[model samples]
Target: MSTNNYPFQLGQDQSRRKFIYNFTKAAGVATLLTSPVISHADSFFVPPAPVTVGEVMDMFINQVPGAPFNSTVDTLKAGNRDIQVTGIVTTMFATIEVIRKSIALGANFIIAHEPTFYNHQDQTAWLANDEVYRYKADLLQQHNIAVWRNHDYIHSINPDGVRMGLLKQLGWQSYYNPVATNVLMLPTTSLSSLIDHLKQKLFIDKVRYIGDLKQNCQKILLMPGAAGGTRQIQAMGKEKPDVLICGEIQEWETAEYVRDAQAKGQKLSLIVLGHIASEEPGSEFMANWLKEKLPGMKITHLLSNNSLSFL
Candidate 1:
């Protein structure tokens, strides 16, 4: 892509803020190190070590506990984990455009909420000969950009990072379920009206649903990300929400299940929000959470827009 096609730039305030932040950070670190040294063996480990990509990754991983999906996919996707980060950019997916934007913002690290290699596991065997994949990989290598997928852990976190981000975006924190967060009780509205509201809020014009436009929907079950067929169906069955807001739906499974249920006169609705729009907000939220964790860094959020577009 041409530099002319680059979509964003570092604003003046951000530049000035970053400069002041670095100056203050230097002073604080100097003071900490110069203060009286502790004599205990544990305390003698020193203070204020430089941060690296691996350190950041470990910080995130430690936030979620127990049996979350742990795999190589969650590890660093590109560049060196040992490299000291200049800045971080959180996004839904690490597309070429987002990568370009990160480079322009002087961010050497990217924390993505989705896969970079077009698949869940990001296996490259099938993409070995693909020219498109090669070009993107080449760009990553050339820039020495580090990318880490924060999917499994983010979802597994106590408050669920994606839900927290989306709620903040939608301003639905007041309506959030106190007992079961997955279940939301909305004010009664027609199915079509709710769809319209989602369309405007999420910037999604179209949606696939399993209910009549005139159907009344109040209770909603929000299942973001590809939670798979079993989990989606099970949630709807257990909660019996009037509508189920999902990131994705399988044609023959969950969608069909909902369709058959609706045909049987069951009060159920299903709205597909697509994968990117559903989880991207959480990645945008990650930028803020990361800012709090590693302050004084030039952290910014670059939206990894949906890959496909409607005509």
Candidate 2:
């Protein structure tokens, strides 16, 4: 579904990322520990233990100990948490179309990458009088659908699940650095070629870049979200990638840093893939990852198109 369906109101979630060493181990234990016991036909009677939407999400995202982003923001946005999920839809955003689509597909659980409500934390106290909010909330209640945002936790997943998904989409599985999840080592290619590759593979319409098109780029620092200027610069300086591929950045912030770096002839380059384009794949990655993790439930990745366009 399009972002426009949610009207002009939008939320920007701040994901504080912490590196964990063993995500697979953590996630696996979480699944086994949190999983609802399966009923075997041979057994006399093993009643299916209720596995609610919140339970599954908590298992998946809480793989890391002591999550910095509290449950007040990560908790359920709509519907009851006790409602058993028939299936799950993991998307970049739970837009109006996605909510209806999930319900149509008989899926009651939606694990979204962004806020279901207009605010970053999905605070409904302020939107109590908003008709759009009422309609959306009422629709979710009518369908008995529950929404949960996987913003901070997913990014904080040991291997940085978000980056893992992008690597899978970009076909750079072997290029991932074990110690540093954000860095990438690739064969030398021009800036334009890399951009073209991103557009073709990621299906992006437009991208913003800083550096000459003909400039040769090899080492890539993939920062897929707006991690702010200081972090962005620190990463760039540390890795010193030929090109920095990122999701979103303020023009006055990291963008200006790259611009000034280029003036100094450091040959540093930058590409902004917009917030949705960069992190969207992570949610899609999450869908695939959930299949093995949540055996009883079918998980689908609902693609959210970039909310911006260029004339």
Candidate 3:
């Protein structure tokens, strides 16, 4: 049979007939041949567009309760937005070790809570001739990794995502009130016991504290990150918590304030958890949230540990 010379397209007709026959036989119903499955067979094989960096960012920004802010530090610090994201890594900071780990894990996008560079704004112009900056920047370029700062957006969320994550990690959610996000009313425990608990929970060796070891602590002023000494002192003044659990503090500010208060017979204390240890939970929370939003996509939380060694 000269099929090529036929006026009617014989191959398409045979394919259609064969498809219907198979579909009917598999479905066990002859009437199912008229179903939309036959018409959609072509489209069923078409894969979805690969998720781009910009698309993921858009989805994230859109989901944030009151996002699309007029001004934000949450900008792409490295790499372009058009590239497709193979995987995501969330961390407290995109240190060189973390960046290398991300590369090893086959991740192309990094959502870091803090700046990648040594500055808050991540300005790289001044570091154009610096060796350390060049090395880090070259590593990112070689791996085609994109680093995006998520500081402002995460902090802007209701109840503060970082604080919520810390509460969850420390099992203090029961005592947390959204209205008073900075306060946690916990069972009465000694200051030393609380420090031990924090060290265990946050996976740290030691923490700098300024209170009598046996002093009882029930109310906690939860300031995870560096909220500045003035803010910390002011919050303590207003909330009057038994202990202030904060990240980092200047030598002369909050510490001196607590010292003066102690001299005056006021029951005040402070525990420094370090910046990374305190906010790492928030990045972990981000990883979990991303998994829900991007089903089937690989998302990991990398611990950006402090480089300083403790005796």
Q: Largest lDDT belongs to which candidate?
A: 3
Q: Could you give candidate 3's per-residue lDDT for residues 96-189 as a string of tens digits?
A: 9989888887789999999888998889999999999999999999999999888888888776789888887776788888788889888777
User: Candidate 1: which pairs clash?
Assistant: none
TM-score between candidate 2 and the true structure: 0.81
**Per-residue lDDT for 56-170 in model 1, tens only?**
8888887787743545468678887887887788888889998988888777899998788989888889999999999988998898899999888888887898998887655
- Model 1 gets an lDDT of 0.76
Clash pairs, candidate 2, are: none
Q: Across residues 128-193, which tens digit of lDDT does each residue of candidate 2 receive?
A: 999999999999989899888877788777788898888877778898988888888777777877
TM-scores for the candidates: 0.81, 0.81, 0.84
Clashes of each: 0, 0, 0
List the candidate 1 regions with Cα displacement exceeding 4 Å: 1-50, 67-72
Q: What are the lDDT scores of the predictions, listed in order?
A: 0.76, 0.76, 0.80
Candidate 3 clashing pairs, residues 3+ apart or interchain: none
